[model samples]
Target chain A: MIAQFPALQVVIPLLGAPLCIILRRGALPWLIALLVSWAALAMAATLLSQVADGEIISYALGGWLAPLGIEYRIDTLNAFMLLLVAGTSSAVLPFAYKSVAKEIPQDRHYLFYSGFLLMLTGLLGMAITGDAFNVFVFIEISSLSSYAMIAMGRDRRALSAAFTYLVMGTVGATFFLIGVGLIYAVTGTLNMADLAERLPPLYQSRTVLAAFAFISVGILLKLALFPLHLWLPNAYTYAPSVVTAFLAATATKVAIYLLLRFGYTVFGAEFVFNIVPASEVLLTLALAGVIIASFVAIFQSDVKRLLAYSSVAQIGYIILGISYANVTGLTASIVHIFNHAVTKGALFLVMGCVAYAAGACRLESFAGLGKRMPLTMAAFVIAGLSLIGVPLTAGFISKWYLVLGAMEKGWWPVAAVILATSLLAAVYVWRVVEIAYFRDAPADAPPLSDPPLALLVPTWVLTGACVYFGIETSLSLGFAEQAAIQLMGGG
Target chain B: MKHHLIPRVIAKLTIPGILLFALYVQFHGDYGPGGGFQAGVIFGAGFILYGLVFGLENLRKVAPPQIVTAFIAVGVLLYGGVGVVSQILGANYLDYDVLSAVDHDGQHLGILLVELGVGITVAAVMMTIFMTFAGRLR
Candidate 1:
């Protein structure tokens, strides 16, 4: 069991999903999924310990040596990612039981759980796998399942959202495949470690540069970076609450992980930074995404859609860190990954709770939610404040590192830009705070109460996580630093 | 959905052949750019052909959508199952050599099982997606 930790990290959800369908009656599937997710979390914990202690665990598929066979590589970065993904799934599954039954039809309940499990499988697999092509395969797995999961929403907009995601996802996947193909054509290898070793020699090759371009574009689209983020707002707005929460926490996080893996692990900083000037493009787009998307978020009438735009802005903070192209920059970006996941996951889950209680969650619907659904709205306020980078919160920690990294590079303007964007976040969050707390509920509305514990527990779990990770830096930042050093080739 | 022969036969022969080719690619994964994923899709294509030629109803009779979906889960589980087996054997995930007394031959078997898992999942997922879309068409 100890030796098989890598496989267990992915296998639990991959296998547990069918068991969900089979044991569809009663609360069994949820229980199974919960147990399996915990198992995965345990595996991740063990892997994290091993990696943090500076041990790299590479599991050979069927005992074939790497550069020839599929492998599950565990280092500090991916181990942390696996923990985030599995931890989120475990956290979310407990909440999904009643929430899903309320949102989805009874007969299709089994299908929904199964799809959820598969999506989990795809995400965790992508995070943990070392093979390049395997990432694409898992991307399809997660993407296809996610499309189905999102489409299961009661609203007709769900279908259109799913369709739009499908088209965009297909395009992203195609780009990723082309990039993989190009890399393979150049080096005849698909393993990340092998690619990293082989790619430096070919740094001057136009073909390698083309591959880098394709991969960056593909990841940018997937991460919903700046101008490429058109598909995200609708998908988030229209998806079933559970689906929205899951994707908010895990999906984009995984894509960011891909970008990190490629930029730092596969391409190496020297070549990627010095050769192609990738950081300049990343920086420009990050700034645009942060400023522009924040403004867009401010005007949205629908609360969920507002947060969706806000997500694009958050993505900018992560990209800005990466574009700095140093240990501090990479660490900052990585820290934000965990921070944003905590913030967004809590925010969206609270939104789901609001939707459940009020049967609506637009800006107007939330006009007096603070008074009616006090705890839920309070959770939202806390998470929203964190997103604004308030001191003593997870979001601030990320922004702090980002600013330091920028200042270290003597890019004071970039540091100023980071401060300015944090202000944008404050404005949008304040808008929501004003509406939810200050205004009046419609006279026709019935008195609303707190959402059930099933939902609120997970909501608070992440809320607690945001503060806990903020106060206790050892878990989040330490892992991120180790991951950064590892990506910089164990500096 | 009703079954029609021309399309069915074409689906049966072509889809099965494509699946076989996918398996070949998966087995030859180390030597080439393809592996478990291609095999999974090809296998999926075969079952999809079965559904196409025999009518989804008839195919459902053979492997119902619910059951097909279950099978898809089973396939991934089977892959994971191998990992568990390796754990029980006190080795790392998918350690095939431990599965067999032979050295590298165990790895051969391990890869085969893992590929089979991917093949099953890919095949079943295709069927599941097909069922969803075909229903929409209806």
Candidate 2:
């Protein structure tokens, strides 16, 4: 039973999605989603602990061998990701009851939960699956479900936003498929482990190089890296608050994991870095993404849109870490995956509460919110501080590693840019803080207090984790270091 | 239009045959090219043709929307349930060899059941989508 954790990790939620539709009751589907997510988190914990020593667990679906069958592979990297994604879902679900009920129509609530579970299944499956084709399948599953969930937002713009994402995301997926097909054409294998073994000898082949290019661009678009990030701000802005929270936290993080897996494990660091100069390209883009996206974020009027752009900038920092392509750089990349997830997830959830009580996620709605929703805003502040890479917060730990990584390479300019971007982070984060804390309530405005305990508790829980993971460092840092070492050692 | 006797009569004549062929495709999936997805679409097309020629209300009388939605859930659960059953029997998820005393028979039974699940879902979903867009006209 314990050995089957990898299969069960994905299978449980895949089944739970249908169960949600079958039940079709108001609270029943939500409860089912909540349970399935918590179960996934628990399983992830067990999987992580089991793989903490850098061991790998591979489970073959349908009892077929790995070269042919769909395999669920869990290593320290993905197990940690599974933990982040599932844990974020679990935290966000408890907060969803009020926010979802407030935003979405009553009739669609069951469908909403069903979509949530499907998205969870897709994200977790992507993290755990060892097959290249299976990653594409899970990416579609997660993207399709998310498009539906995003379209569920009350505003009609949600429809167009979803359509925009649909088009861009489909193109991205197609490019990735073409890349994978190219690789399979050359190597005749879809298994990541097998592909790694076969890929090195063919690294100089043009087909393999084109395959690498397509796959990198496809994943970059999905990851919402700077130039390719047009679909994200609106999708995140218009999505129902819970959808934004969950997708913001986990979806792109999984894409980053996919990028790292392909870039380091399958393609091999030597091919990606030394032979192809992929590191230099990625490093340049990362710098531009952080500076430009942060500039864009500070100008947005809507709070959700602002945070959405901030998310793009944050993704830049992650890519910045990745572009360094060393042990410390990879560690920063991995730890930031967990750090940014908790911080941004908490921030979006807090916005969800604001949306529930104030009826908008715009900056104007946040006026005098500090007095009314002190605790919620407080959680927002702490998570906001974390986003700025303030000391004794999770975001700080990521930046610390990122700076060290840049310095280790004697890239002093890159290290300076990392610090400069943190100030940009401070600007965007402070925008909301200023409105919430300094501005006075309008005369005709109704009184708003903290949201229900159900909402506040989950928001704080994630917020507290931002600080806790910062100070404690063992669970997230230990696993991140282990994952970094394993990736560097090759799959 | 109900007044179109020729179209209605042709639909009636061919729908049964279409359904029959769908069944054949579903059952022979393990050996042939036609499987759950293709079989399911063929089966659903028969009903969709009926709804188009005979009117949605008449189609609704024969197959309600609620039941169609329920069947979608049922199909997925059925498919997933088979995998769980295999797992409980100490094989990995979807390991069909443990489903019966004979390994070959278990694999056959497993494929057949899974295809059946897919057929049911695709058929129901096809009809549901037809009804939704077709009903939107009224």
Candidate 3:
């Protein structure tokens, strides 16, 4: 049973999905998904603990040897991601019940839960798998389900948003396939660890360069980095509230991990920074995404859309850390991967609670939410403080590492730019707070109460995590540091 | 014989032309970087075209989604299963030399099974996706 932990990490949700669909009763699937996700989280923690102590767990499917067979390899880097993904999924499931009921019709609820579970299975599999081609397979499984989940929104525009996402997602997946094909040609192996060993010898080859270009572009599209992010805002806005929360918390974080894994580990830091011009491109885009997305977020009428755009900007901070391309920089990127997931999950879950109470998430809909739903709004406020990187929040720790990394590189301008972006974040988050607290309530609005405990508990759980992890850097920063060292060392 | 013969003949002749190209790429995989995935897709496309022209009900009679899904899992299982066998034979996971009753034969046999597994999984999943979408429309 202990030896099977790696397979169990994926098999639980992968098998649990069809079982969820078969059961098809109200609340049952959600409960089952919650249990399975928590199981995965526990497994992930054990794996991460093992890896942090310098152990690598490689589980072969059916006992096949590597360089010829598929492998699931767990190191500090992937184990951290496995924990982030599974942890977020379990947290989001409790909230999904009420939120899904309110937004998705009863008839479609079972399918929605099924899709959610399948998406979880795909994401976890992607994060944990050691084979490069397996990543593409899991990515497609997740993307197809994601498109379906997004389109299930009651809003008609959800359809078009899903369609646009499909087109872009397919193109991205294809690009990744092309890159894998090229790598396979050069190294004759699909296992990532083997490729890392084989690629450095062929570092000067044009073929490897082509593979890097394809994979980088593919991952960039999936991460929804600034220029390639056109499909995200509408998709987030139009999705059912539960779907948006799940994706915002988990999906892009997986993409960022994939980017870091490939760029730093598989390709090596020297090849990434020296041979390819990834650093400069990442820096320019990070700055633009932060400044432009913040300005855009301030003006949005719809709250979900505003947060969606804010997500794009937040991704910039992660990329900015990577652009620094050093130990502190990599640590910043990795730490933020965990911190941002907590902050955004809390914020979006709170948004869902408010929408459940007020019947809408438009900025004006929150006119008097401060009084109507004190607890949920407080969660929002705490999460907002995290978003702005206020002290004693997880967001601040990620930013501190980022700023330190920039200063270490003697890039004072970059450090200044990061500080300036935090100020812009303050402005947008302040706009939401002012509307909720200070504006007069709409006269016709009926009195409302706080969201049911089922939703609020998970919302506060993540908000609590945001603050807890902020004060306790031992786990997040320690895990991040070890992972960064592994990444920098090309392990 | 005529009823089965006509479709079989058309399939045998035309499908071979298409699959001939697929096999070319599958074998050329090691040399020029093409392999099981492309070959599998091409072979699956032939079956899909058969279903489309001959109606899905007819296709389902021969190969259903349940079977396809099972094949998908089994394909992965087969791939994984091979690795376990190698380990039991006193080698690391996927060490093909352990695969043979004799030494050198193991590499070729291992590669064949791996590719066969890839081809099976790819084709099955392709058909499964098509069936799922078609079912949604209905």
Candidate 4:
């Protein structure tokens, strides 16, 4: 059973999803989803522990041989990713129970849970699978379900948001598929490990270079990297709050993991860096994403859209770390993945509560929220602080490492930009704080209290994690260090 | 209202044959090109034909929406259950080799069960999608 942890990790959710729809009663689907998410979290924990000593755990589906059959491969990098993805789901689902009830119509509850599970399954499958083609399949699975989930939002614009996401996501998936096809054409294998072994010799081939270009662009679009991020703000803002929280935290993070996996693990850093000048391109884009997105975020009136743009900026930090192509840089990127997920998940949950109690997520809706919903607003403040990389927070640790990575490369301007962007983050976060605390509630406003305990508790748990992991730093940083080493060591 | 006797008669005649072929495709998947996905679509097509000629009201009578929704979950559960069963037998999840003493027999058994599960879910979901869209029309 322990040996099968990798498969069990994904199968439990895959199985539990259908069970959610089968039961099809109020709260039952949420309960089932909650249990399944927790179960997946436990499995991910076990898998991470198993791989903690830097051992790779590979499980062949149906007992078939690797390269000929599907394989679930767990390394330090994927193990960390699995934990992040599953942990975010576990944390977010509890909050989702109340949020979903308020946001989605009753008849669609079962479909919501089912779509959530399918999305979970897709993300886990993508992180665990060793086959390049399997990643594409899982991407589609998650993408299709997310489209459904996003469209479930009560807002009429949810339909357009889902449609826009669908069109863009399909193009991204197609590009990724074409890249995988080219790799297979040259190497005659779809297994990542097999391709890794075969690809080095073909590094100079135009086909391989074209494959890299397609795959990178596809993944960057999926990650919502700067300039390619037009679809994200509305998609995240208009989608049901739970969908926004989940996708904001995990979806782009998974895309970043793919970028790391393909860029470093499969393509090899030397070829990706020295041969193609990918680092410079990524660095330029990362800088632009951080500065431009942060500036854009500062001007947004919708809080969700603000955070959505902030997400693009945070992703820039992750990409910037990766562009350095050093252990510290990669470690910063990996650690930021977990940190940003915890921080954004908490912030979004708070926004959901505000939407629940106040009936809107616009900046003005936050007026006097600090008084009406003190704990909820406080949770937002803490997460907001983390977002700005204030000291004694998870965000600080990631930025610290990111700056260290920049300085190590003697890129002082990049380091300066990193700090300057945090100040921009501070400006945006402070806008919310000022509105929530300083402004008074309107005279005719309905009495609003903190959200129900079901929602509030989960929001705080993630907020607590943001602070806890920041101070402790052992679990997240330890895993991230090992993951960075593994990536740099060529897996 | 027109009875449309010719179309109704053709639908009535072909629906049973279509369903039978769907089952054949599902079960013969391991040895042939057709599998659960193909089988599910074919099965759903038969019901769609019935609804087109006999009316959705009559189709719903044959396959209630509530039961169809449950069927969707049941199929996925059936597929996942096989994997869980293998895990209980002390093999990896979805490790079908441990399902039977004979390796080849276990493989065949596992494939059959999984394909059946896929066929059931896909067919039910397709029907449910049609019902939802058609319900909107009414």
Candidate 5:
């Protein structure tokens, strides 16, 4: 029973999705989703503990041998990701109850929950599976459901957003499939561990190199890394508030997990850095993404779009950590996966609350909101501070590790870029703060209050986690370090 | 209207055969290339042909949106339920060897059930998507 935890972690949510539709009631599906999320969270926590001492749990489907069967392999890295993905969903679903109700029509409520659960299953399945092709299948499942959920947003533009995402996402997924197919064509095995062993010997082959390039570009697009990020801003901005919050926090983080998994685990650090100029390319892109995206974020009038661009910049920081290819650097990347998810989840949930109360997410809509919705606005401020990497917050801890990683590499300029970007982050965050606190509300502004406790509680839960994880640091940082060591040590 | 009669008659005559072939493809998946996905598409195509020939209103009357929506869930649940049953049998999830006394028997049972689940869901979802898109025209 205990050994089955790895499979149950994904299967529970996969089953819950269809169950939501079967029940066919508005609130019942939400209730089922909430329960499924908590169950997944508990499963993730257990998996993390099991893997804490550096043990790996491998469950073979249908009791077949691993190379021949689909495997759910758990180690420090995926376990940590499982915790992040599941934990974020658990936190976001409570807030989703109110925000979704307000944003989506009553009739489609069950469909929304079904889509949400399907997305959850996809993320969890992607993290858990050891078969490379399985990741593509799960990615499609999640991507398709997300398109549906995004299109369900009340705004007519939501349809275009979904369509755009569908186009970009299909291209990305196709590239990924092509890469996986190429690797399988070369190695004749789809299991990741087998590929890791088989790939190094074929590292010099052009076919392998092409496979790597395709996979990297596919993952970068999915991660919305800078130049490939055109589809994101509109998708996040136009999607319903709950959908925005959920995707903002979990989707890109999962994509980053794939980037790290393939780059370090499958490709091998020595081959990636020494054989190819992959590190240099990653470093260049990360720097560009941070600078360009942050500059763009500062000018956006729509708060959701602003945060969407901010998400691109934040992803740059994660890639920067990965580009270093050291233990501390990878730890920074791994830890930021959790820290950023919590921080961004809180910020987006706060935005959802504002949208719930004020009925818009435009910057002007936030004017004088600090007085009208103090608790909700305060949650935003705390989360925004974290985003700016203020001291004593989750964001600061990741940035600190990122800088230390840079200095460890004797890249002083890289460290400077890190700090400069924090200030850039501050500029964009302050733009909202000034609008919410200083400017007067418009004459036609409806009298607004803090969102219902259903929304506020989850927002603060994540907000409080941002500070708690920042101060404690042991859990997130500890797991991240262990996972980083495993990746760098070529697990 | 008179011109439509021939196509509608052909569709009515051929629909049962398409459905029968779909079932054959679905059940034959364990030993052959055909599987739930192929079967599901065939099943969906049969209904789509009915709609195209007899009109969508007639098709909806035959299948109905509510039941088609429910079938989607039922299919997935059927698939997932098999996994849960394996878990209950004291093996890992989807570990079909525990489903019966003979290991091969369990594998057969597990694969058949899961494929059935997949077939049902895919067919229903395909129909749903077609209806949603076509319904928008009205």
Candidate 6:
């Protein structure tokens, strides 16, 4: 039974999705989603602990062998990703129950829960699956559901946002499909380990090169790296608050994991970095994403949109860490996935609580919220500080590693740029903090306070995590360092 | 369309034939070219033909949205349920060798059940899609 943890990690949520639809009711589906997410988190924790000892756990689906059947492969990298994604889902659900009730139509709650669970299943499956094509299938499952969920938002613009995402996401998925096809065409294998073994000799082949290009671009679009990130802000801004929180935390992080997995494990670092000169292009883009997106984040009037742009900038930071290409840089990237998931997830969640209590999430809505909703505002401020990479928060730790990584690589300018962006982050974050604390609420505004305990608890849990992880790096940093070493060592 | 006698009569005769063929294809998938997806689309087309000639309300009467919705979830459950059962029986997930004491019999039963699950989901999902688009048209 314990051996089946990897399979159950995904299957539990997969089953819960349909069960939500089968037992469609107002709260029943939410209960099912909540339970399923908790179960997923539990399984993810077990898988991570099992893999912590440097053992790779692979479970073949349908009792078939690895090359023949679907495989759920978990190592230090994906096990940590599993924990991040599942843990986010678990935290988000308690908040979602209240958030969804307010944001979505009462009758459509079951549909929302169903889509939520499907998205959870998709992220988990993508993290765990060793089969390349299976990731495509799970991406579709998660993507299609998210499109629907995003479209469910009350704002009329949500429809267009979802449509834009649909177009971009489809093109991205199609490119990914083409990449997989080309790889399969050349190598006649889809399993990651087998492909890793098979791909080394064909490093010079143009087909393999094109496949790498396609795969990189596809994942880049999905992860919303700069210049390819036009679809993300609108999608995140207009999505229901819970959807925004969930996707912000897990979706792009999983995409990053995919990029690292393919670029490091399957393609081999020799071919990916040294052969293709991927480092410079990725580094330039990461720099651009960090500086430019942070500038954009500063001007947004809607707090959700502000946070959404901030998310784009943060993705820049994540990529910057990745583009460093050293173990410390990779560890920074890995830890940022967890750190950003909790930090950004908490910020969006607090925004949801604000939106729930205040009717809208515009800049005007947050004015003087520091007084009106003390606890929620405090959570927002803490998470905002984390977003700014303030010391004793999770964000500070990642940036520390990122800057240290750049210096280690003798890229002093890159290290300087990383520090400069932290100031920009401070600017954008302080914009919100100043608005909330310095201004006074208008007389016309609805009287507000901290949201119900349900919303507040989850918000604070994640906010507390931002501080806790910043102080205690043993768990997050330990796994990240281990995963980074494995990745850099070409395991 | 409902008032058009010739097309309606033709549809009435052809619908059952289409359905019979769909079931045949659905069951014969293991040995032949037909399988769940092909059979599902064919089966769905028969009902779509009924709605086209007889009206969607009539189609709804024949197959309620509630029941069709149930079929959608149940089909996936049936498919996944098989995998879970195999896992519980000490085989890998979806490994059907243990479905029965006799090895070949287990394979036959497993594939049959799995195909049935797929056939149900595909057909029901088709109906659901039609319901959504056709509902919008009205």
Each candidate's B-chain TM-score, in sequence, is 0.76, 0.97, 0.78, 0.97, 0.96, 0.96
For candidate 3, the TM-score is 0.83
Each model's C-alpha lDDT? 0.86, 0.93, 0.86, 0.92, 0.92, 0.91
Top of the candidates by DockQ: 2
lDDT of 6 by residue, A19-58 (tens): 9888997699999999999988998898899999898988
- The lowest-lDDT stretch of 10 consecutive residues in candidate 1 chain B is B1-10
Off by over 4 Å in 2: none
A1-491, model 2: which lDDT tens digit per residue?
88778888988999898888889877998999999999999999999999988789989999998999988888999999999999999999999998898898888888899899999999999999999999999999999999999999878999999999999999999999999999999999999999999999998999999999999999999999989999999999999999999999999999999999999888999899988878988988888999999999999999999999999999999999889889999999999999999999999999898988888988888999999999989999999999999999999999999999999999989999989988988998899999999998898999899899999999999999999989999998888988999999996
User: What is the DockQ for all candidates, taken in turn?
Assistant: 0.47, 0.81, 0.11, 0.77, 0.79, 0.77
| Candidate 4: residue pairs that collide | none
lDDT, residue A130, model 4: 93
Error of 4 at A76 (Å): 1.0
TM-score of 1: 0.89
Cα RMSD of all models vs. native, in order, equals: 4.1, 1.0, 5.7, 1.4, 1.5, 1.0
- Candidate 1 regions exceeding 4 Å error are B1-65, B102-138
Candidate 4, B12-88: lDDT as tens digits: 78999999999999999999999999999999888977877787899899999999989998999999999989988
Which docking band does candidate 1 fall into? acceptable
- Where does candidate 5 clash, by residue pair? none
DockQ of 3: 0.11
Any runs in candidate 6 off by more than 4 Å, and if so which?
none
lDDT, residue A119, candidate 3: 94
B71 in model 3: Cα distance from truth in Å?
A: 12
In the range A17-81, model 1's lDDT, one tens digit per residue, is 87887678877776777788888888888889888887888987656679899988888889999
Categorize the docking of model 2.
high
Model 6 clash pairs are A62-B93
